[model samples]
Target: MSGIYIHIPFCKQACHYCDFHFSTSLKKKDQLVFALAKELQLRKDEFKDTTIETIYFGGGTPSVLSTNELQYLIDSVYLNYKVTDHPEITLEANPDDLIINNIDALSISEVQSLYKTKFEELKKTGINRLSIGVQSFHEKDLKLMNRAHNAIEAKRCLETATQYFDNISLDLIYGIPNSTNQEWLENIQTALSFGIPHISSYALTVEPKTALASFIKKGIIDNVDDDLAHDQFHILIDQLNQAGFEHYELSNFAKKGYYSKNNSAYWLGKSYLGIGPSAHSFNGKQRAWNVKNNTIYIKKINQDQLPLEIEILTKNDKYNEFIMTGLRTIWGVSLTEVKKQFGESFLEYLLQQANQYINNQMLCIVDNRLKTTQKGKFLSDGIASDLFKLR
Candidate 1:
């Protein structure tokens, strides 16, 4: 099944480690929403034959928008696309927007009590799932990361969110400098305590030109500890598995029936349309990405021209993508798929490359699918890179 990803390119404030496209100013917020609706209408024919099973509202910070604004966009999707009867509509939001202010300072939080009203409102608007960005549950860590919400808001949001929605996911960050193994475990423990069915965790990466990167360059911040992150990754794996969660993807864990449909579809290479600035779209053979500049994107959309770059995927490109994505998921890379799509030469090339990893117990051929072992899970990307077909 296909999906629709509408990027709400606005944020209340910037996070230090973030590099996603967003505008702090909402001066053009109304115009941007209208443009997004128009873009949906324009791109509807791109996937005319496919039925949309998921609508993911990812963003600079979707919670920054009003509930009515979110509903307006959902209505636009319904009006323009062939969505399924019960689509999994998700909103990516930060904890602060979902909870009352300064919930972390007080011993008792009324933030959760206030959440009932917001959750009910969102439920009425057809948002079936929430992906809360609860990066950490430690106040010091929150401040270090320049997060708008504190530790208590992170916990408070989930305490209430779980009451209203069962299909929820939380995002956590690991590998921040000085965050010890004990601290990271505590973060995991705190996350599990919230009873969230799904979690998407990632190591703290220093993206070029980001505030974190700049801070590091200026010696204001220490670089990420790779060894510590490695340790924490394994800890996360063991803990989540012990807690009965499936290590479905490299960065995601979920209980049965709670995996993210939008992300799953993407990993499976299913078609999806991405609307808004700096968003990317893929339709199997070709990929398109909208312009990063908000003003440029708006101007082009206003003139009925899509301001984006397109790339036609060659055989090598497609095969490499399949390898990268396939290796990350439990599904693994299929030998049959390689032979069927890319010929014997490529299949042989893959098998020959995978042999080393397989021999080392880092990868193995189970039912003809080349899957990674627990030892290779943390190093999956590097292993996958070594197996890439050079074009």
Candidate 2:
């Protein structure tokens, strides 16, 4: 259940809300690509005994790279590591990159006809799944977020992508300022129309130093209403559940047999290697992350050095992470496993800390596993922190 995550640290333009490490320039594209392959080769021994089951291309925008560049990286993975026969290879794409023809003038049928070639080229590169970032279907929402594509382009991309890839996922953001409840519902319904097997929806939080945060601070845009976000979160859960999608994690919903293997491995605490700038990796006992600066990452890798920092997890660190990730998903924390792994003292501390929430009916024990009640799902993070064994 191990995986590899490759970060593509480039984008055509910056999204207003994004604070991730990436540059708008393609000047270093070639060097970065070569460095990525070199890094994979250098780190092969780390996963010598592990079989890679998933290869994920995540980013600033992985689709910004050409099919050839993507194929080069995939080839590097096969050359360096042992991959499973049916590894789930995913590419996070934007609608603008997926649609070759002008979406504004073309009909859905016409766009699909023109778009087949691009998707076919992508599929030939061994990419079996596509996670498209179609944040909203309304022009206003797109404009507010400064997304790369319009509402039409989003719909057109999905209309065509569905024909080529069965295992497709789309992203949607809830809790935008000035967005009404009805508008939020419309966004959900429109995404469901695409018939995507998996959906990763998130509440839009204004991170510090991001344009969105600055705008709210200066009155350029209204601040995100917490009450509105809370309402929309419930709206999302109810709508998706009725549509026959499993609310597998706090923010991800999927049809049966379509859960994201890469992400599931992450939550279950499986070992994985993170390649590329700003990517994080985890084994059961330790976690590491690459340098955020692309130039430094490339230079270090070219010099046969890993520009990364490692953190050896203490027993409490592992326990806290398990509780946080565990409570966020349907597969809750196993009390027996906790005692077995972290010992009776750690397990006792966890149960003592969790008793308050359990009494409030926000958390409960089912088959000896600690899980969040529906009433507490939206507050899982807060509850998990409360249950943490802080020193």
- Give the per-residue lDDT digits (tens) of candidate 2, residues 138-252: 9998998999899988998898899899999999998999999999999999999878889999899999999999998999999988899999999999999999999999999
Consecutive 10-residue window with the lowest summed lDDT within model 1: 105-114
Q: Score candidate 1 by TM-score against the native.
A: 0.96
After the best TM-score superposition of candidate 2, give how far the Cα of residue 206 lies from its true spot, in angstroms. Answer: 1.1
Q: Which candidate has the highest TM-score of all?
A: 2
For residues 1-391, write the lDDT of model 1, one tens digit per residue: 7999999999888889999999899998988988998899888899889899999999899888889999999999999878899999999999888876745665444654566678899999999999999899888778878998888778878887888998999999999898999999999999999889999999999999898999999998889999999999999999999999999999999999999999999889999999999999999999999999889989999999998899999999999999999999989999999999999999999999989998899999899899999989988999999999988
Off by over 4 Å in 1: 102-114
Task: State the local distance difference test value for candidate 1.
Answer: 0.91
Note each model's CA RMSD in angstroms.
2.1, 1.5
lDDT score at residue 365, model 1, on the 0-100 scale: 89
